[model samples]
Target: MQQQTLVNFQNFIIATRDSGYKSTASALAELVDNSIEAGATKVEILINKVQEQGVEQYEVLIIDNGKAMSEDELNLALQFGGSSRFNSRNQLGRYGMGLPNSSLSQCRRVEVVTWKKKGEFLSNYLDVDEVIDKSLTRLPKPKKSTNCVFSIQSKSGTIVLWKKCDRLSFKYLKSLIKHVQFELGRVFRYSIWRGVEIRICGETIRPFDPLFIGEGVNLKGGLPYGEELHYQVKIPNNEKKTSVVKVRFVELPVQEWAKLPNEEKRKSQITKCAGATILRANREIDYGWFFMGDKRKENYDDWWRCEVSFEPELDEVFGVTHTKQEIKETEFMSSILVPDIEQTARALNNRVRLKFIDLKRIQPQVFSKQQLERNDMYLPPVKKNDGLVKKNNGSLKIKGLEYEIVTKELKRDVFFDVEEVDNCIVLTVNTAHIFYEKIFKALHSRRINNIAD
Candidate 1:
């Protein structure tokens, strides 16, 4: 018979700590996932900075009002791959490694405390330094404790505490708080909108819908491309299992918004909303250019947006990883989704291009009207004796002009309209013979405050 040696716990813990979590926010998201899976309505994240051995360090705490674990359960929870719901399909947690794997990835020590009722708290912990020193060979057995990691206000709940956080991405608590707020806001937007409350450092987190379609968060004049498209895809290997995937397209107000100032555009995330947002189980999992087939991304694509949402059961099809930060886009997924998405993308792209052309044709007339209204405003001095010398091919040539010319493709009906100011000629062409109807008529319908709008 072959003899097997005991596994090196010290090396295993240290090696697994670097499990490739993209950032501290992602690692923290794993803990939130567990809380959500437990049916927690309220979750709180707290950060505390302290001094130890003349060195400054931080501790993280995640507390939730969920079903508390018993002493036996607590012991197993501290161990890797020891979740009771391991491989369960109905819940968010698939593998049992999220708890310990995510925790140790960011910290050298982690403690879990739970209680089913008042005065019945149980606590257990895992320390990396203790394991490496050979002083602690196994996870401490859960025992009754009067003092909890953080005071559990609820009758039954769980709290996860992280100490010796040497691997955190953000060194300052304020920076980490800002990142966590934005990340978790989008990650759990659906849940937050559905009445789940998540608080960071005593501040309630609000849902940040990336599509900007939700009430109270939409663009001022944005409109949806069309009704949402739905598709039902059967699981590759499981004949009995099927999942529904939803896709939506939103066309932002290009004509009205494209002229916004640079700072305003950046604040509104106009360029950042170009690609598709992938949501798994209503939580945004990954966002990138997906299912566009051979079409490469371009600048005009920023004017339109796409969102793809699918059920958790289709994780394998979408290639969702344990970290839940990205998707692999398996061949099967691309085959089913790319065709339709690509066609719609092409159509939207053409629509945006045409709208931009129309806007360009209409801009000169708008500027001309502005000049009339602001006639009393300051204007650059024109040199004396700058008079029209002759009319050349419907454009006026002047003596000592030194003026810049802007050309436009206008309808044949109207030759050109010109407004000379600030040593420049603002020329407008009658494109499609509807320049007045498109520009003057449209401007009359809505109020125009500034040129930037």
Candidate 2:
């Protein structure tokens, strides 16, 4: 039998390009993963807007100060599923498909240049146009190339250039930069926290801890709810071997953050974000309702968070994909981890609900605060102040609606007075009235005593 080609090079390359990389950020992440595995401390992603045939297009250049590759290593890195660190359980890379696969998914041509010794740069590339035309049967031999990445280098570095781009997201420039930075920050929060610096278009990417329990964040949440869950999950590749999986839960400050502006809540990714962040080897892969069987999500659930982290050895258990954007369903994962997680999730939801209930109980006037917005935010502001001197009025706004409840000595015979101040409505009960000395004071005392019951 005459041995024929295993795959149609033209069609395969095109199909591979289309098959991989669901998002521009995911593809870029693969390249950065390689850089991190190479021990890169500093990485930069530069976005360039170029005009091609009267149309505006974008090109990306990824530069890293990692250990550069030699000619032989560079050749292998350019090939599909080729890596010296294949199946590496400790490092970020595993299948070795990241470099070329990630690059071609965004652009038609990708050139990689690397150097360890000064003035001895090695370069290689894979061009979609060449493969389709059959002019370039294989990767052109890596040769000495000009140091296009940097003019000066200490010892080693690598540069990846993407050209003829087509598969980028619809957003560009500011939008694209913002999206990438947000995603990279969340996905690589651990790496960033570990002193890895990632800059996009000269702007430094900050770590965005989903749980909101870390420092340097504008928002904060309560401490971890319970003890960390540890599981020695079996590694799919080696049935006899197993790895560690850590699970933790956190409760966001519902009473503290529930009154923030809608935009701030949305920007902080707290509203409607009731899910766990699945981390593999300290890198976030999937973030959703994982390992929580039959648990329906609710508004109160948003007040809590979960994080499940595992070693690279248990990738199959987590159903991690090559894209690493999301996880697929795994029977082993569900059967092993779901019960405990689901139970804890329910407890957390109940805790949040009860906390809100307690808040309402402590502040019986909370309903007034709620109504200030539901029934009256559309009303015009009051320019006419209350006919009294304002000192320590203790007036405040909640969700942009001003409200106050205080006791004051009213010269009138009324039990209470309702006055609209500049920005709020003040409900002042007469302190000298019999309603305060008898009904109001006694009622509050009984309610306070009921707390012990």
Residue 168, candidate 2: C-alpha displacement in angstroms:
1.7
Note the Cα lDDT for every prediction shown.
Answer: 0.77, 0.80
Error of 1 at 165 (Å): 1.0
Error of 2 at 364 (Å): 5.9
| Candidate 1 Cα errors over 4 Å, as ranges | 1-7, 215-222, 364-453
The CA lDDT at 365 in model 1 is: 38
Candidate 2 least-lDDT 10 residues: 444-453
Residue 73 of model 2, lDDT score: 87
Best by TM-score: 2
Best by lDDT: 2
